[model samples]
Target: MTRALVVAAHGSHYNPGTALPAWRCVDHIRQTGLFDEVTAAFWKEQPSFSTVLDGLRSNQVIVVPLFSSEGYFSQSVLPAELQPRVGQAIRITSVVGSSAFFTAVVADRIQKALVKANFPPAETAVALVGHGTVRHLDSRQTTESQAGLLRGKFAEVHTAYLDDEPYVADLVRTVTCPNLVVVPFFVAEGLHTQDDIPDALGLSDPLYESQVIQNHRVLYTPPVGLEDNLYTVVLALANEYSDSEAAADPGLSSELYWTSHQLAQFGQVSLHADALCHVDDDVNAPDLEILDTPEAIRAKLRFTDSGEFRPLPTRRDLPHGWKIPAPGDVSRWAALQMIYPGVWKVERTCSPHEVGARQQGKYRPVRDISRKKVDSLVQSVCLHCVRHPSWHDQNLESVPGCIEPCSVWLEEAIKP
Candidate 1:
């Protein structure tokens, strides 16, 4: 009867904006009396998934990922972190929150943005650009899924990506539409949304462009984060967990609630320690100083259960213009290296903590069992999961991209 709620998000040390919507989702759910307990976890940041379960006060819990599409973190990281046990008889339900409804929402937002700009939606070529991968076809599937629903709702719809086959550049060759409007299917307005996509479209700034990309007469909408309609996504997820179908066992719900509370306590403690590095004047901070030392990194992994993003400490005395506050992680590490090479050294690592048995667990032997179970459980959950695991775990290795840096540092060569 113990029911708990874990809303997982792909956290970034490099973008506060990425985690913002996930947090908003958790807040909306808590406002409703849906579960005996509710908590949020992240792939990065504190409240690490390693120890998220210790906080569960409900006998049953529903986990919803606040991602725009099914990608690696939703599949591999989330399942591994919430690794299920056979005999525990824990009634855990996982719902993939990336829905076709989101596509309609995005389309609606685009129509409105264009209307405000005095452009007709029927005349504009809506290009939904996503970050696609070559490994798993699901990233492309997700974009296609979005596009399919969008095409049904709108007159003109097209799709593109940053990587893999049928790329953004191909739009110039493939798309037959005349008046193009690009809408990035991304959660934030980061480098790719700002610098890379715009550059590819051949516009200095579509906001001020007198000429358009490919001489196709284009219009670029602001990244989706700036749109206000996203709140609907969060509200709908909370309703899913709180509705009448959820169990009414007070005892079970109470236990899960208490468990979630305890996990939250432990999570907050580790979160504080993890944030400590933010204030440390250590020049090696970007190199993941926490992961460099065994004990230092172990401190953050102490959570027996409970996971989610919490505030980290940053240099309080940093002067304005000295350094822009950057989210700290590997993808950002790579982006920064690509953008400002001299500012930092990029070192690739292979020994991910979540890798095989040895690096994954707190102890070597237990780690082995956990790793084995992790493999088996992932396959099992994917087969019976509410949504396709391929949709979430878009990467081939079934692991997060950022953590691969440190994990690789320990085992393999660091390549971009």
Candidate 2:
């Protein structure tokens, strides 16, 4: 029987780096050749929860939330969005953050940070900083649990929160330790880890590796979620669902076999005999860079023409004037995936009406908005996006269209 693994994560619309750890984990798992398919889905980004499972062909599926705590997202949002399938046997595993393996990973991070700082673990006080919410206790509970497990190994292990009582700033100011190490209990290094945490810790300089704060030699480590061995924790969480007895099918090949018709257009990108080109007519004529492989295409799309990082590929800001050679059907489909991840599968599985209904039903922010508000939001947000809501009506198969309202639009609609 075919098996699939879906790594669910809370991706960011604003910061692209927020989703890298989960994607990296997916790449590692895909390399193992254990599952027939491996894909990453996000709550706030593309290949969203609404469409992640739409195109899977697996008989058995396991979804592991790449969350650090059994908080609002992992406990409530994920289960609600990942609806039960009709024929497939789907199992949602406990979050990676709650796993015993993750606890060890955090401990390992703290130990390594201490050793690198040349501080003895016995004399160092560890501050486990978490993004807690006042609306729920799960975040605080998970943070305290990890701290509890490390109390004996360190001089003192204190749990602090960005949103809850005993705030991160308070802990940094009052913790009694000659040497302190702050470890962010986050899945990725986003604005929280890069700016908020550092600011709360009283570290003004962004480049400072270590600083003297309140007479304590403070050493801040990268977020625990960015740890290189996180794939092990993901595998450990899904171990029960993995079939050791079943012979593994060599997973989906990178070379996608597509027919000539399917290669004609990819949203705003078009394929030609000599090269693959952007369909947008308004883009300024720039020097066309030669991109031969899918990897090269992906690298080119990472930034805009002006060299600014393009976090969202669906945005209309796709840097133009790049040419990809039209080698074979494999290269064509592979290039489409690189340009718009999961769009081809989603287009095949869902109709325009189904996608529209999903956006209205699954996303409360989109559903709650008035028709006028939606029109205004769309004019402001969707107009600048490469994908269009009306593409289906226009019968523009080449123009990538939104099946459901994206997180960016939802965020705009929800704003007061």
Candidate 3:
């Protein structure tokens, strides 16, 4: 039976930015390739919750709300829109906040801060930042709940807010811990994590030690929903009702999943060209290369891993127009694209133009690559970048150098 996972999120009508975290979670889950389809729906955006099932062919669908609380939206609004018809099964999982293992996830995060700064528990203070809507008492309950769990382990535990009391700007005045660590209880690092909250707290940069705000130096971590272990948390949330054959690989680690190409940049690994077919081979393979025009270069610009171009074997068609440089040319391709964007596009498909659009003065039409093929490539690049050491070891500013060159940072965004 065809199965799907529809992640439901309460998106914004006024600000499209709020939906990013849910979109990110959707992207994260989709990369695992655990189901026939993984998609997203927003309550206030296009494909709103009311029409969430308008185009689903899956026999079973598991809708998991990305909310961190089981308030009115998860308990009432989302459920009201998720009715399934005969031969179509729709199962709704509990909100992510209800995950039984979340406390453990919190514990792990706290430990990382301790290890990073090696601060004495006696002096370091932990503050959990939340939306904390004063209108709804239950809204801040999750923040309170996590703070309670962390209190036993950290010397100082504080709960600050954006909408309610104990404003993050006054964190130092309210929470008297010497070295403060603020963890945003957010689904994603949208405007709040990236700006509003940081601004309130006087943070000048993202993911770094902030200049003393109100006389206190603060260290802020990335938003909570992007946690690596949260994959397990999400799977656990979906499995409460998912009967599909997909099983979570708890032991599978992306820690070393770096492609051989990435490793060769540092002389840590090698790709022997003699053992592989060269790009000049004329082996007949599927022509899945998409073109925007006759001028479009037909190379495997999409970095997918489901399989290779059967028409050509290995690096045989790589460096499409030039000789594959040395053995680790694929990584070099990524580096070249990064350091030399202008030069790298020479071999990539032409910038996609709308079909029937007038280019220069002549009308031109073009077709896109097969969705499945692009999906395969996008997933491969996503997995590669998301698991790269730079993603974890370095901050966001340093992160793009690895992604932009690889063309995984959406040089070719899927027009969802």
TM-score of each: 0.57, 0.83, 0.55
Candidate 1: tens digits of C-alpha lDDT, residues 1-416: 44556666655555445555554554555556456555566655433343344444454556666665666656555666565433222322323325644655676657766766555656666778887887656766776777777675545788888886667877755656567777877765556777777776666744633345665667777666445556556545544654344533545432222111212111112112123222224423455433332222323322212332222211012111111122333223322221111111112222222344433322223223334443454454333321222222444332111222221122222121
Across 21-55, the per-residue lDDT of candidate 2 in tens digits comes to 88788878877877777778898776787667765
Instruction: List where candidate 3 sits over 4 angstroms from the true fold.
Output: 11-24, 27-34, 44-47, 243-416
Give the winner by lDDT: 1 or 3. 3
Clash pairs detected, candidate 3 = 278-316, 279-316, 279-317, 285-311, 304-377, 338-405
Question: Model 3, 219-287: lDDT tens per residue?
Answer: 787767656676567666776778866643333322222223433232111224421212343223333
Top lDDT prediction, candidate number: 2
Q: Among all windows of ten consecutive residues in candidate 2, which has the lowest summed lDDT?
A: 344-353
Candidate 2: list runs displaced more than 4 Å: 84-86, 243-247, 250-261, 270-300, 320-332, 345-365, 372-380, 388-399
Give the per-residue Cα lDDT of candidate 3 at 408.
23
**Could you tell me the TM-score of candidate 3?**
0.55
